[model samples]
Each structure stands twice: as C-alpha cells, then as structure tokens.
Target: MHPPAHGADTPLFIVLNAASGRRDTDAVRTAIESACNAAGRRCRIFLVDGPGKLQPFAREAVERARAGGGVVVAAGGDGTINAVAQATLGSGCAFGVLPQGTFNYFSRTHGIPAETEAALQVLLTEPPRAVQVGLVNDKVFLVNASLGLYARLLEERETFKRDYGRSRITALGAAVVTMLRGGHRSWRLRLAWRGQERDLRTRSLFVGNNALQLHQVGIADADAPEEGQLAAIAVKPGRWWSLPGLLVQGALGRLGHADDILSFPFASMTVKPAASGQRRIKVATDGELNWLAMPLLFRVAPEPLWLIKPAVAPELEAARE
Candidate 1:
C-alpha cells in the first residue's frame, strides 16, 4: 500500500455538526479531543449549529488543507459527511468521517468504526484511499440516491423523527406507516442505462454507491464500490399487500430473486419523466430531499475521492485483490 498522503505535520481539521442525531455534542467533542490527544495528532475542531453553516465551514477546512496538505474530518452523520466530502472534491484533501449518525452507512462502508474514539484512531493513523463517489445532478452522495417511493419513505422517516424520536425502531415504524398510508406512488420514468433507453413504470428507483448496503439489502451480492459502477434497483408497481414480502426478501438478502425488483449496474444513467412537458422531479440523495430539474443525470464521478479508511478495513482488502 502507498504511504498516507498526509503525515504528522499535516493538521487535522474536524468540522462537527452539533445538531446531528441525538448524541450529546459536549460528550462527542470531549471524546474526539481525548482520542486525538491520545493519538498524538494535532487537531482543530469547529462546531456548527446547523446545515446552513456546514458547507461554509467545510470549504474553509478544505482551503486550509490545500495550503498545507492535511485531513479534513467530518464529525457527524451522512448528511454532514456529504457536505464536507463535496467540498473536498478536487481539492486533494483527505476526507475522514467520525460517524455520529443513525446509519453511518458511508463510514461503515469504508470500514470506519462507529464509535468516536476508535474512528478517531483510524483517522489519525490510516492512509486515505481513493473511493468512487455517486453524483445525481450536481450533488454528490456517498451512500445512495433514489426517486419515487424510497424518497417518500425517507421524507416520512424524517417527519416521524422530528415529531416523535429518532431510532432504528422508529425508522422501521415510519416505513411501515408510510406504506400503510398509501404513500407509494408509481412514476412513468424514461431511463437510459448502459446506452439503452427504456420506458418503465415503477414505484421506486434506488442507485446505491455503498456496496455494503446493496449486499445487506440483498439487492446485489458483490460489493464493488471501487469497480467504478453504481448498483441500481428498481421496484415495479405492485399491490400494497406485496410490500411486506418484498421487504422480507430484502432483509433475507434475496431481493434479487424477487420478480418485482430489477437490479443492474451502471456507470451513468438518465432518469426523467416519460411524459412530455414535465420538467421537474423529486430526488433523495443520501436521505436529503430536493426537487431537481427534469432528466436527472446520475453518474460515477470521473475521479475518485480520497477517503480515510481504517488500516485493517476488510473492504480495502477486497479492493486490493
């Protein structure tokens, strides 16, 4: 393996989101400080109040790193990490994550520990490796992006969390309630994949950048994030009663066997309204929702981002071979 691009002299800039998840900010900050101190790494932590400040703070960190060649660590959930990672793109700054999210899918996919201290240790000592990033329109996502039903589910999940509380159980409940409430809606989509164009009606379209999630959900058997491809799954419109069976298949890692689920790999694709004159569509990238102009362009970024991973990451081992 190549030596890490940054060394002891390279300062560590941690951009933390104070409102991420339900973790106590003071406790997380203390843990980060303790871990960095124990690792003998010189670090500076910047805490932001909300998403509004995350991007600006991350951009500043990137500028600092570009001047001196350092690591910029995002110390929050996937949203926080996505903001920082997007800023670090093309800047040649090593991106690190201190997982403080409910899923931490991005961090876990790269073999970073969920615990603050252990993840810090990896951030302080490990080398940054190149990892593929997924792009929808102009936004970059480290995990997955989707349209239709999955997007609605994410939106409902957030609403549930805001009104009730955040937890895995609550998320599951939200999914169930969302489905029961007849939230799944079919889209007449014109999809261009692998140079082939097709018109299809589907309830959900998921493009996964994190191979681990694809495998875990049984959408794909191979975890090949470094292979320069995105794993995509589309669900055919079906009766509401069929949703549970599909869910079961996913949970059992057999989603590929389900008739309604279509799985494929693609370097890029175009998704837009099949009907004429429709100029906008809603997309959820890494659980953040937005309405983008029609004919959404999704692609694997031309250049991979340099992401910090644990020295002993199993994913890294797999990538090496």
Candidate 2:
C-alpha cells in the first residue's frame, strides 16, 4: 500500500473513542472542528461511544477516506489507533493519530507528540509515511501482544482503572495487586518458530512489535522489529516473590540481565495451547482484550499502514527555502 497524496483540501474521517483518555470528548470534538474550519478541510467525526461501535466506525472511516481521497484519523489511545489501523491497512488511505492514551507507545515510538493539542497539528499538516505493523492471527497490533498471565493482568488493570481512574501509576498498582493476589500457575504451551518447535511452561508470552517499547524494557535485540522481525519474551517459572524484582528490573531497564526472562527475535512464531480441545484463549493486543482461536500466529504484517508523520520543523523548512 502507498501513502495518500492529498493536499489540505483532503477530508479527514476521524474515529474518536469517547472513553479513551483524560480529555473531555466535547472539548476534543470542538477543537477538531475549529482546526478543520481554519484549515478549510472537511472533518467528519465518528464517535465511538462503546467497544462494539469501534469496528463499524473504523470501517466507515476507511470507506469514506478511500472514496474521497481523504485521511482516516484516530483520536484516542493505542488500542483505538490499533483498531482504526486494522481497517485502514489495505484500504490505500492514509492514517493519522491524535495520541490521547496513557502509554501512547505507538505514537511515541513514531515521534508523534503525546499531547492531544500538538498531535492534532501534526495529524493535519504532516505527510503520510509507510510504517510497520505486526499481526497476531491477522489482527493488527502496533505496539505489543500477549497471552496467559499478562492478558489477565490487563483485565485486572481495567477493573482498577474503573475504580481509581487511568494513569501509569494506576497501571503499576494494578499489576502489583494482581501479581500479589492472582494465580501464579504456569501455562503449558507449544511454540513453533524459526523451523523448530518446543514445548515450554510459562506464565506469560509477550510478542513486541514496537522497537521503542522493547528497548525501554531492556530487550537486547529490540531493534529486530524495525529490521522486519518480531521480538518474543517468555516469562519463565519462578517464585512469586521474584516477580516484583523482575518488574523493578524492567522499570529500571535491566530486564535483559534477568535469569527468568527468555527473549527471541524471529520472523514468525506459531503458538498452540496445551490441548487441541483448548481451541480458544484470551489475548491482549495493544492493551485491548479478546478471545481468539488457537494456534496463534505472530508476525510482521505483509502490508504497511500509511501513517502521517510529524511535519518538518518550520525553521528547517525555512533554511532549506
């Protein structure tokens, strides 16, 4: 797929999730409307009021953008961006993001501003650039995907988010509580990658697609994703008391030196649950939860999403001129 070559007059089909970030939805809508008026571009807003509405809105955005040579923009967090990107992947339309998520890993990794105000400006003025996306059972994930204990952690985090609100600190607290009280049992699974298959016991299996995230977590081969490969990390069985130390190591960017962590960089991986009858399992992609049929496949997507990158700095452009 190629980038959409439309100018300022190109319409913007926006998918905005109402509950995504800390920003007021009405304020965001007003800001976008005002910006579109100033730029003399059409802004069509598709409000995602619920999770079930996201796919329909994303599909609508892709369709409208493709029909009118416009750009499909997602104004939310990483999960929202992932959903919209899934729709725009092969539609030959450009994708834009207004980062409003807690982590905003996908936006941060690509040099997009985390603030909604600055991100809005870039979404409007920047040109589309081809960017890599990872696939889990054909579902697009821009940051990371995980199974087993980590997916359960996300569920616990959501419950805490509902009670205490959303933030990085809240997420950490949730993780701590979940690990302290939740089950510490390992999963019996089979992994097939790089022409070899192995059965292993793990508490969590995480596949990372964003280089910045992996690097921040102290993965030695984090750059593998940028080089057209995905990075996998399996949490080996260890005492429950050791999990906190590993978490601290991860936060300190020293997880690469940990003994309980196993990392692999590969082109693709096929994962199967312990029994054939266990056909479906819970998975989390970019922090969104779902149940998918196994054996799960993780790899780089064949097509690229045309992402509108940051515009060149005005001073640099002026110097060139």
Strongest candidate by TM-score: 2
TM-score of 1: 0.93
Tens digit of per-residue lDDT, candidate 2, span 1-321: 446687888899999999898889999899889888988889899999876899999999999998899999999999899999999998889899988789988887777887677788888788898888899999888999999888989989999999999999999999988888746779889999989999988999999998777877788877777788989999998887788788889888788899999998987899997666778889999999989999999988887888998643332233222
TM-score of 2: 0.94
Candidate 1 overall lDDT versus native = 0.83
Global Cα RMSD, each model:
2.6, 4.1
The lDDT leader among the candidates is: 2
C-alpha RMSD of candidate 2:
4.1
Q: Write the per-residue lDDT of candidate 1 for residues 75-191, one digit (tens) a residue.
A: 988888988989987787788899898988888778998888788778877778888899999789889999888898999899899988878888888887877776467888999
Where does model 2 exceed 4 Å of error?
A: 311-321
